[model samples]
Target chain A: SQQGEEDPQALSIQEGENATMNCSYKTSINNLQWYRQNSGRGLVHLILIRSNEREKHSGRLRVTLDTSKKSSSLLITASRAADTASYFCATDARETSYDKVIFGPGTSLSVIP
Target chain B: DARVTQTPRHKVTEMGQEVTMRCQPILGHNTVFWYRQTMMQGLELLAYFRNRAPLDDSGMPKDRFSAEMPDATLATLKIQPSEPRDSAVYFCASGLVRTGRTEAFFGQGTRLTVV
Candidate 1:
């Protein structure tokens, strides 16, 4: 079974609106990272949030992690059409080896222009 | 400018044939991972290596699939007598084993179709 699962498998929003995607995991983790994938291409790293950190921001992207709940959320502010893609959450679980990272199914987001 | 590079962006082969995919991770990154993606199984970790040593490979089929990091920069995944069910996109990612936080950089992936 996968360690991480993202909610609302698919989402759609206006270009200027805010988009939020949530991910839940079943284990203790050292850090969680978010990635975006365009159609027919590989994934691109978005941001990484350590377990000790509660919230992190990079430009219009914001990520929040709650270790107690084993859940994390990614928020994209003022969404643009370019932001339309599949978003995935990956975690480096404490139970796994140091270099291994497990991935979630992902959420497909469509931003309307 | 540092990026993971994968060879033969696409491949198509017949069943019972052998297929191999290669990845060249970014220099200075000591950890490499292999992943398979399909419509049903999302992104699945097949194997991974740290410091050119195989740390884990339980996710891969021992009979047909094998992964190896022959050198610091190159990683290979080979499938012998491939089956139709083996068709999927394979990705390679590399990252550092840091103290608290580590970031994974992914390659463009190699799409394989076993006919």
Candidate 2:
């Protein structure tokens, strides 16, 4: 079963606008990571936020995690046409001995140029 | 740069035929995962291996699917008598699991078409 579920199945916005995607999971997680996939391409790791950490930032990407609510959000500031891709959130369950990462149904984001 | 590598980037086989896919994880990475992506089901975890040993394969169809890690560097997923419904993009990912950090690197998926 998929642990994380991303909201807003699809979103479209202007190039300069900011895009926000949210992911909610059911069980406790050790860490949450976000990934991006361009059309016909493999997924690329964007950023990771550990459960002990509340927020993290990397380049134009900002990620926030709330362990109590079992939710995480990815914010892309000043979105560009290059940002047009599917964004996925994955969770590493704390219950598993190994890092069994479960990915969620992604949010398809289209940054219109 | 080190990355997971998948062979046969595009595969088209007839229905009821056997199909085999291979993945080579990065050196020293302990975890390997296989996923299938389709329009209906976004990404399904078929199976995974830790330290060259299978940890879980419940997500795969035991009748037609089998996954194995022959060695620490090689992982193979095989489907016998593949049906049209088995047609989807298969992805291989490798990651290192430590105390606090986990990140996976994906390979360009193999787009399978079982006609």
Candidate 3:
């Protein structure tokens, strides 16, 4: 079983609109990270939020984590066509050793111009 | 600007044949990971090595799957007598493990097909 699971397996939106994707996990985690992948390419690290942090931001990307709910959300403001890609949430669980990260199925986002 | 490199971006082979994939981790990175991605299974971690030592391989099928890092710069994943179900994209990632923080850099991936 995967530690993290993203919602709305697929999403589509127009440029200039905001996109929000949610992720839920099954266990306690030390941190959660978000990654973006273009088709036929490797994943790009987007952001990371530690267990003690509630929110983080980087440019147009914002991530929020709620430990009590074991959930996190990624928000992209003013979407652009270049933002079209698959977004995955990876969790570093509290019990996991070696800092092993488990990935989720991912949400496919298509931003229209 | 260093990146993880994977060779043979694409591979096609028949069932029962052996397939091998290689990865070159980013310079100075100490941890390497091998993962397989399919439409159904998504990304599954097969094995990982830390500081050139095998740390975990519990997700790998011990019967036909093998992974090793012969040195600090190179890692390999091999499957003998490949099965149809083994057709998927294999990804190699490398990262530096530190207290309270870590980030993995992924390779372009190798797309393998078994006929």
Candidate 4:
């Protein structure tokens, strides 16, 4: 079963506009990570924010976690045409002696050049 | 930079044929994982191994699917008599487990089509 669900399933944006995607999960998580997938290719790790942390940034990516609300959002600042791809949020749930990470359906962002 | 690698980037087989996909994890990584992705199921973890020890395989189907890590470096997912419904992109990921951090790096994935 998927732990997280992403909103705004598809978004079209201008090259310089920022794109934001939201993810909601059902259970408590150890950490939440964002990933990017190019069409027909593998996924790339974007940023990982631990439970105790509220926000993190990497390059043009900004991720914020609101554990109180069981939600997180990924914000891409000054997006470019190359940044057009599918974004997914995966939640690492704390299980006994191990962890299970469940990925959401993902949000497809298309940037017009 | 170290990364995981998967073979047979694409495979098309008729239904009822055996299919095997292989993965090579990054050196010194102790954990490996296999996951399948489709338009409907999204990404599902089929199995995982820690130091070549099978940790969990509850998500895999018993009748036709099997996953094994024959050694520390190699892991394989085999499907006997695959069905059209099993067609999906199978991805292999590996990560280092140290302290309280677990970061997984994934391969390019094998796109399989069972017609």
In model 2, state the lDDT of residue B85: 97
By lDDT, is 1 or 4 better? 1
Q: In model 4, which residue pairs have backbone atoms overlapping below 3 Å?
A: none
Put down candidate 3 lDDT per residue, B1-115, tens digits, no spaces.
7999998899999999999999999999999999999999998989989999988998899999999999999999999989999999999999998896678899999999999
Candidate 2 lDDT over residue span B1-115, tens digit each: 9989998899999999999999999999998999999988998898988888999888899999999999988999999999999999999999998886779999998999999
Superposition error at A76 for model 3 (Å)? 0.4
Q: lDDT of each prediction vs. the true structure?
A: 0.94, 0.94, 0.94, 0.91
For model 3, the stretches where C-alpha displacement exceeds 4 angstroms are none
Interface RMSD of each: 1.0, 0.9, 0.8, 1.2
Question: Which candidate, 1 or 4, has the higher DockQ?
Answer: 1
Candidate 2 chain B: minimum summed lDDT over ten consecutive residues — where?
B95-104
List model 1 lDDT by residue over B1-115, tens digit each.
9999999899999999999999999999988999999989999999989898988888899999999998998999999989999999999999887787778899999999999
Q: Which has the greatest DockQ?
A: 1
Q: After superposition, how far is residue B103 of candidate 1 from its true place, in Å?
A: 1.2
Contacts from the true interface found in each model, as a fraction, amount to 0.86, 0.76, 0.65, 0.49
Stronger candidate by DockQ (1 vs 3): 1
RMSD of each: 0.8, 0.8, 0.8, 1.0
lDDT for model 1:
0.94
Candidate 4 regions with alpha-carbon error over 4 angstroms: none
DockQ of 4: 0.67
Q: Cα miss at A46, model 1 (Å)? A: 0.6
